[model samples]
Target: METVVDGTGRAGRSGRRWRITSMQVLCALLVLAILGQDLLREAFDAPVLQTAATVFVAICVQALPFLVLGVLLSGAIAAFVPARALRRVLPRRDSAAVGVAGMSGVVLAGCECASVPVARRLIGQGVAPAAALAFLLAAPAVNPIVLVSTAVAFPGEPAMVAARFAGSLATALIMGWLWLRWGKLEWIAERALRRLPDTEGRDRWRVFAETARADLVDAAGFLVLGALVAAVFGVVIPGDWFSSLGEQIVLGILVMAVLAVVLSLCSEADAFVAASLSALPLLPRLVFLVVGPAIDAKLFALQAGTFGRAFALRFAPVTFVVAIGCGVAAGLLFLGGVR
Candidate 1:
């Protein structure tokens, strides 16, 4: 009886520890801000700090709605759309199926986080791995929400939207074809290839809600981090770097490509973050958009877990190179040789 009571007390303590939620953290931060208001105000009074704060707020405000929308649509796809249905729609020929999969991304609006599981399910449902990969690459980048957000973010640069779409679609198709030609099935993990049963009826809504709630929590944290990084870049980075690199476009492209991988911004929110970096020319920013949804640090981790490290190691680097090449070509063609 004494052992049982002790075990119960320990379980209760563990439960309490697990209950320290994000909301609790946020409330604690809010309380600290209130307590330290005078100190914060004096610190933020610096012109650079003030600018950074403004940029951070602006990015969060502009990107939040789209982020919410992306997650909701993602949940709907996960709940309503069955993997077998997607497999049924693909053409018998692998090449044609890849094209169809790439184009299909326009209708299936979701962030990159949502695409991975769906792609895994498609593969398990007997869809061609190459075609499933094409969808995974394209869904986050070419969807209406992302393009519309890009249009809103850039406002007047219609070509930015066009270039992003063309570049992302091209990257998807190219990667799919490459996989068809050279990828090994054994590279994917046995667990990832296991088929999942589809959700049905009333259970679907439960899934939709849970998936949306979980994705919003995960993506929102990353969105906030991306905004903070953009804010710092805008104010903290030396102005001369942007100025000098603007003249050396190749160096600018390489830098933005690396930033895209490192920042790992959500597709629905990356545009606003990219737009905040007005120091760089349009081409580099376009590369940031194209490469981010294709592969980033978080995405590499996700791929490593889902497809296995061997697959991710080979696929991510190739996708990065292909995305950059497509981004540059599309920018030159659509943006007319970089602004």
Candidate 2:
């Protein structure tokens, strides 16, 4: 059974509380528009609304297909790739293992949220914690949609594409290595891998369907949570915040990294947020992009619940450093000088 929604009314409701609330808020805005007229227009028509819409749509479009892609690949891997085979493929040494693990994301496409369960399932099936950690960080950023969106975000900067991919890969691998050396697997939640009650004896197609359906169901609430966060970030956090940071580029990047961790916006959608930081120069904003997929508040929360605090504490900071370094290099190459 799909955990978020089971192809039923309750499930659908679980998935799209925003569509409903959006209507409610929009209707209220319309009412305010009629009664207060110009006042409502003045408040609602502020640039913030436009900016929010721009960032919101960018994230949703970029993430949804990739999320679907990731979930499907994860499903196929679970249903088809024998656990024994996976165990063989994942390397044993820490750095090499991380490299092998991180590269696995090259084939799977997904957002950070979607990547979590897949990683958990892999671990359950005996894929090393090192490899699983790498996959969790990589699957979101290196996905096609994320890279393509990076290209879009930078307009003519083809290097942005390379930067996003390389940065995401570097962070994931290095972080994986760190975790294997210093982190433990005690962080993953037990309830995360429970089997669905009635799906046995099904065909591969059915298995895939069941997996995808369950993913969509399980992720619906999270999707709503992400959207609401984007919506709120839309209303709060003025653009001047970035502009005001001045020359604290490293500090700024670190701050945004923290924000990325907290917000846990989908990889697809995070680019627009990074772009809107036009005031913050390119490097830090790039760091925002790089750090986001690997560590975000939403992602951290999920990880803590499913992967454990020990894993998170070790994994998050190392991933942050690697990603920031990548962003700095990319900025020097493409952004001229973003110090």
Candidate 3:
């Protein structure tokens, strides 16, 4: 029967994958053993290498709990919630749904890392992909914790917080509309569309646990990879770039935007980082805050893992451009030419 053939094929593939993973792990261990502690110490003695390692560990430690929370929430949504019910709850019109999704982001208090898996779950659960993506972009930027932190970080600059909120919200909405208009379903990885099997009977808890564990493992690996990449950039990027204000305003905006993507700071703390860069004008800092949550190295890795490389490649660049423009417009309107 066809079912038997399919099952056999699946088992064969699983076995091959397991063997490959084991071999890879064994090889890694062997290499590490060969290098020994003295080599590692020698390497770490270099200032740049040491700094990168420190950043890698710090990012992993800070993000691990939120990543766990994200996977667990995603698993709960998959196991207990009905896609039909979610569809019913969302607005009928896609445009309206996008707006609703952007606004709904206020409820999620976690950082950018948390939103990646959650957005993928939303798409798999029958929500419009564009709307879900909007929520993903908005959540970390516009959440109450982020807003409040911004307020506290810049005590006297109420306009800074307002501009940040407005710019981030605008970026989300614009990306949603752009996706709806131009995005192709095939651009998303096929794996993202596949639904988690139902566990209505005795296997509900097992399903939840398995789903969460698998997502955690997969996402955590990519998160670590991203953190490593970010660490390298962190060491390479000059500190003087933040300290020295360039005469050309456009250059400052562009540098801040690029730095945001490179830094990959947590949304809850990014406001403080931006605030600490007092040498930069409010406009550039606003761009940094808005762009960090929307698209960063870690977020891009998470997206590529969750959605697809094709999707991330197209999405991240567009988001960067949109965030910059939105930040500029918002700055002009709210900060009145960047105080």
Top-lDDT candidate index: 1
Which residue runs of candidate 2 sit more than 4 Å off their true CA positions?
Answer: 1-88, 91-94, 185-200, 203-241, 333-339
Error of 1 at 68 (Å): 1.2
Can you list the residue pairs that collide in candidate 3? none
Per-candidate TM-scores read 0.93, 0.70, 0.67
Candidate 2, residue 9: the lDDT equals: 41
> Which pairs of residues have clashing backbones in candidate 1?
none
lDDT of 1 by residue, 1-339 (tens): 122335445522223234677799999999999999999999999999999999999999999999999999999988888768778889999999999999999999888988998899899888999999999999999999999999999999999999999999999999999999999999898887887665565588898999999889989988999999988988888878787887799999999999999989899999999998888899999999999999999999999999999999999999999999999999999999975
Error of 3 at 11 (Å): 24
Task: Give the alpha-carbon lDDT of every model.
Answer: 0.93, 0.68, 0.78
Q: Give the range where candidate 2 is weakest over 10 consecutive residues by summed lDDT.
A: 192-201
lDDT-based ranking: 1, 3, 2
219-266: candidate 3 lDDT, tens digit per residue: 566556657655765677676764465456788999889988987766
Q: Looking at model 3, which ten-residue stretch has the lowest summed lDDT?
A: 11-20
